[model samples]
Target: MLLDLLKLHLCEACSMTELHEAVALGDYDLVAEILRTGRCDPNHKDVDWHDRTPLHWAAAKGRSELVKLLVDHGAQHCLRSDVGWTPAHFAAESGRLGVLRTLHSLHAAMDAADLFGDTPKRLAEIYGHQDCSRFLETAEVESRSYRRTAAMKGIPLDQRDEDWEVKKEELERNPPYSRENHTSSAQKKKGKKRGKQ
Candidate 1:
């Protein structure tokens, strides 16, 4: 396939080769064409560390437009290198707030705790990105408040105001035993004794 051929060509390209050149040096145009044509996988790994994807490079370099393009083409936002750092983590570490925001908007899981128990919010704080940390903190607080209010209203957290279908189904599946059943069985025994008398 064309994708396989391009992967082969890119793998042969040297470490010193610019990714734009590795794709034949057409810059963003060539990268976009390769992605659009499906001639190369944007998720391809370089040979040296095998750790860097095009997305990783784009994010680390703060190439926001290129980052968006790669993400739209299905480049994974959560792909971690051997050291356990995701593209979002790298963006945060590099202080690329624009790239980080773009990734977050794409639904990259900001709450995903890494091996060190550092979510994107924690990473932002550790790396001195106070603005990013503030945004994440506000979002988290709002989400928690919503859940608490829903819980206090006697609603199941899973229901989330969807007419309680999930709660209804749960009750139906595990219906409680009725006192009527026990009382009726007792009455049946007493009537048998009276009939015998």
Candidate 2:
């Protein structure tokens, strides 16, 4: 396995990490082997892919076993991408109900919102993933409940990404214009043109 990995590394000029490649390819055995080696950080973000971790890939691919393996190996469930999307968001978008269930069972953050204030539930709704949306509706409530309980019990929760918080705060301080604003302005111009005609 090591020889195969070494040969792949020597041959491929891709910048993505071996772990990322394995997860992206949905190679369960290869992923397990990589995790066992303990040489790679499971939480290492692929900058080329908008700072997405291996866990995000597993969730997006709906690999329940891979998701379990990654989390068990100390992958941070709260890690977000460049756009502040958690693994839950990807799973919801792709209608990965089993992946969502697996993540919830593992105590991963299910109610986290992205930079655009879209929760996993919202993404499920937008993507017409009824099953995922329904599951997320209850999961969101349960997630909040346990999070509050953990806080009161003084149990540390790995639900917040500190770096993302800083970036979020910065964005809030100097917020950019929303796409809605652009669309509204275009609509108003069209209305005025129609009235003139």
Candidate 3:
């Protein structure tokens, strides 16, 4: 069975080693081939310290093609390594503008914080990537103001007002799931039980 063969031949650990080698040698075609087969998990980290993903290696080496391939295959852009660095952070720190652009186009969250609460935007500025820093600023602004419902209205970009409402009837028609509400109810129940005690 192909699945069985893949399981037997595709060592997650070995894939990391191969990924490092491919990045070091800049064998993007070979990297793509390996990734296409679905044998290598692009999100896998090295066994040693740092535990960097394939995206990390490709970004650090400025291997834009390899980085794109890994991202297209569902490599997590938001994953933080042991050193608290994401692929975008690495790209910015290494001055890999191409990799940074690819990541941004994919909607990789520019403001995603790592363990130290440092976002890629901060890293870009700190690393002196003026273009990347500017892109991150624009991305953050767009995210804060743009709405999918408003986008459906086909309003002119220059004329759209912040006060435009989606309609209360429409909002009432589709009440979104509230996990917070559920958690609050659970907390209330716990509080009542504690009071009874």
Candidate maximizing lDDT: 2
For each candidate, what is the lDDT?
0.59, 0.84, 0.64
Tens-digit per-residue lDDT, 1-197, candidate 3:
78946753665746366766676578988888767776567777675736677878887778778877887787776665653566777777667778877776665655555444566677777656798788778765554355343467874322221211232234346545453444322234346767998
Which regions of candidate 2 deviate over 4 angstroms? 1-15, 176-197
- Please give the RMSD to the true structure for each candidate, in Å: 21.7, 7.3, 14.0
Q: What's the distance in Å from true for residue 53, model 1?
A: 1.4
Question: What digit string (tens of lDDT, one per residue) describes model 1 on residues 44-114?
Answer: 55546535677777776777788878778867766654334556666765677787777766655445444
TM-score of 2: 0.82
User: TM-score for all predictions?
Assistant: 0.56, 0.82, 0.64
Screening candidate 3 with a backbone cut-off below 3 angstroms (N, C-alpha, C), the clashing residue pairs are none
Weakest ten-residue segment in model 2 by summed lDDT: 181-190
TM-score ranking from best candidate downward: 2, 3, 1
Give candidate 3's TM-score.
0.64
lDDT of 2 by residue, 60-164 (tens): 999989999998999999999877889998898789999999999988889987877788898888767899999999999999999999999999988988888
